[model samples]
Target: MIWTLFLALFFLETESSLTQSAAIVPQDPTLTIGSSIRVTCSVKPELNLKAENLYWTLNGRRVPSKFYTVLNSTALNLTLNNLNGSKQQSGDNLLCHSTDGRILAGTCLYVGLPPGKPVDIICWSRNTKDLTCKWTPGSEGETFLRTKYTLKYKLRWYGRDKECQEDHTADPYSCYIPKDLALFTPYEIWVEVSNRLGTASSDIITLDILDVVTTDPPSDVHLSRVGELEDQLIVRWSSPPALKDFLFQAKYQIRYRVEDSTEWKVVDDVGNQTSCRLAGLKPGTVYFVQVRCNPVGIYGSKKAGIWSDWSNPTAASTPRSVSERIAGVCDPKSGEQNSTFRRELKQFFGWVKKHAYGCSGLSIKLYDQWRVWLQKSHKTRNQVLQGDKS
Candidate 1:
């Protein structure tokens, strides 16, 4: 009976040891890139084991022999030196196993890249209230290569003895010029781009702020069917009344597009002349037209000045045949009446210009008046044509 009891006791002790071996647990699972982490394998009863046989593997691949060391027989620690927080190395499973073959534990690690670059840096003069520096998106990093950018800016005022003022940072590259910059003076601006590897600089851009002056819109905008076969349209208008003779150097920009289309084609090179022609238009199609001015000085040595607000949109349709329309209206007896009508029309325009506060309603009223005149003129010409036919 004693022998039977001994066998049962030995069997119970074996089962307890097995249960304890299975209870070994691993350390925490998360680790950041470029950081160190310690992993431990714990068992219930510490086994006085040697360090040489402790093994570590990441994702089933053995870590290099020199990268880590085994602590006591029951504990193993790893120091991932200079860890590059790359996605490929992040969240990978790391396993530590002992030669006793009974203790094993694993942990998962995570790595992350740096932050994105800053945006929308605007430079304005404190003195002139003019925007001196404006920039769009700069260069970024490659997908295979983790990358970021830094921005820097420099501002220099003419005739000032001080050196250029600059603002920037290695990370989140952006700068803004305050509103207190001197007004009515010229300033030069520059921007730079940088990354973890190197940097690039932009060419200097210069701008001038003029003393604020009262300005008015352009006047006498007229559109007429000009070309014969191709059915082109010609637009003409006088310069803004507020423009002094010295500002006559201003160049005009004409923008036009078909009424049915949303795209706006620009003629940036319209010279000092007040007229511009748009060709290659579809015959019998209605078109909308507008104009703006860019005041350039010094024969392009300086950048063009700020653009004026766009003129009121005027519309004109190409006639199918100019000769037929003119013949219907030509009458020697009606010449006196036509002259009187032209005089009245000029007076009406003058009154509108004087009283109109440049409001949208005023523009609509002008367009409506022109439309009424056109309808009346067409009816009169039709009556003359009918009389000639009879």
Candidate 2:
């Protein structure tokens, strides 16, 4: 019984394959957009089907009967005009169905335009190591078909063309070369995009690995309050450590924003300085600061390196104004006490600027310093009065 069941399955599979092979004529024809074609469906004499009994459907929707033509008793023709591009990348399915709505035969129609030329090719290296390149697709970039993108490069003066193994996790139009990049020699890079329609190439861009190099963001970014300056903060950062061995002069940029604001104020005049003084800020407010670096003239090459990513944000707050504190804390009715308090407060902050560490100019030591200054100021005032009387 088992043997008989296996034989029955084999016969069914064979009949299915034969039925598909003998049905659709010009099976799976790829035509260009706006083109027209006449596809024929022929039924086997044994199926006892008539030409008028067969209907057509495309992508599971019924085709209009007006487009059908009766060729013979066992054959029918479908005339499609002014075809558009396939709705899917896998091409559109056209099927011939029997009177019972059973699918008899099927084919795929490929309709699309050739890819346009790739443009705006750019390449850069990270730490003079593996290179990466990206390009913009030409025209609409949508061919409505399966398309392939390849990044090709070679040493400009020597060596053969090699395909850049694409990193799938990267952007769809970008590729990465992890290692084995030449430093001094110029390299030519371009991209080629292709599909069933046609292929296109981008303009070749030639660059040296050393010239197009970038580095990691500036490290060890520290932001602090400027000494006794209510409206300024000082931002300092270390250079990108990886590029120190290379011959390059790196420039820096600093940007900062208040704690409650998303708008950033950028300082562009920092030049090559590792430290910059940000002025004209709201006092008593915390600010977030970040820095980035650009290496210029690397390896004596004239081309400027790409800017590194901005460093992680570092936070610090400008010192509160002495008047602001006095307005909130001092007793308004006591004129003498208020005067004496303001004087001691000024002296305390001045001393904090000179000697305080890690207190943001408002240390617990401030009260002790205020007491000492009060005692000294009274003695000095008395001595001056005695001198005046004498």
Candidate 3:
């Protein structure tokens, strides 16, 4: 019985020794790039580890002995300075190895660059139903890791800070706020950016819904000639679909460029009209035109709101180039006195055929009576008076 008990104790000790392995202190550390770090590997006392037999490997390569110190026979310390983001983020494995080429223990090191503060934050709402905010990233925008941006906002008076879920904006740095908007209430908005390294926030921007109600870009922009004029074209477009039902006066702006030219000329005095006559354009030249709208007096607002995005461009050409005399009209356009007289006569006859107000009948009756009187008089009174004076 004593022999059997000693044998059982011996088996237990062997099993424990076989199971022993090196372990890392502060396993799997995460740190900022360029920061210094230290780690230790330790084994059970029974393993009889030696300082000369232990070594370190980083990313499948052996680490120099100058970077480590032997704390004791079973414990080895490794130090790394000036960690880089790319190397650490790629799951750099730091392993404690024995001289016999057996990996005892290992841990992954994660080094990253922190996000910088965001800048140039701008927010706008569409018809007061939704708000969108965009921003430029802080210094060194690229952090090697995927960065997350969240837009947070709250009413200035009372409300819990809320995260914006709809961030599918055209600008990558933008977020959408969809609900719980008040026209009169001012809102405080900001963006928070985070990554594995660290997090940063933008400065808070406060604004009212009405003051920033910029509508979508204008659509279905149409272009046509103004009457028969050669140098003029009329540009027309409808209000944004979201703001059409809202009571607001929209002022339009027009810019045009020749097909061959890269510069654009802006027409700033379009006022609140949906259609404006563009005069002084080159005749017979294809031109590209764009229009944008600024909504004013929205919901009886005394101040003007922001301008909407420019409409998708549209193209139009002026009347065929005309002789300098006619200022770009169709060729053979009435330029002479006879042509003008014929045009007037055609207009007169058109009036007679249309709404003459019985004036056509009156003119026909007077024409026959005047003919009969002139024939019966035999000579004019003015002619006889001139003959006697001679």
- The lDDT per prediction is 0.56, 0.82, 0.77
**TM-score, each model?**
0.40, 0.78, 0.65
lDDT of 1 by residue, 272-344 (tens): 8899877667656788889876555622325435566788989998754333454554443688768865875
Candidate 3 lDDT over residue span 1-390, tens digit each: 999999888866543332267788878777777898999989776677785679999888999999988898888888999987756345678888878877888888877778999998888878778888889988887676667888888899897899989877566699887887888878889889998778999999988888778777777899887544556788998878878776347777889899999998999788877787777677687888999878777776666678887888899887654343234444453567478657646755565555455663656434333323433343365467669999
Off by over 4 Å in 1: 1-128, 135-178, 183-246, 260-269, 274-283, 298-314, 320-390
Once superposed on the true structure, which residue ranges of model 2 sit more than 4 Å away at CA?
Answer: 1-22, 329-390
Q: 207-276 in candidate 2: lDDT tens per residue?
A: 8898888889999999997665667788988888988766347778888999999998888778888898
Q: Give model 2's clash tally.
A: 0
- Error at 231, model 2, angstroms: 1.5
- Deviation from native of the Cα of residue 238 in model 3, angstroms: 1.8
Maximum-lDDT candidate: 2
Output the TM-score of candidate 3: 0.65
Which candidate has the highest TM-score of all?
2
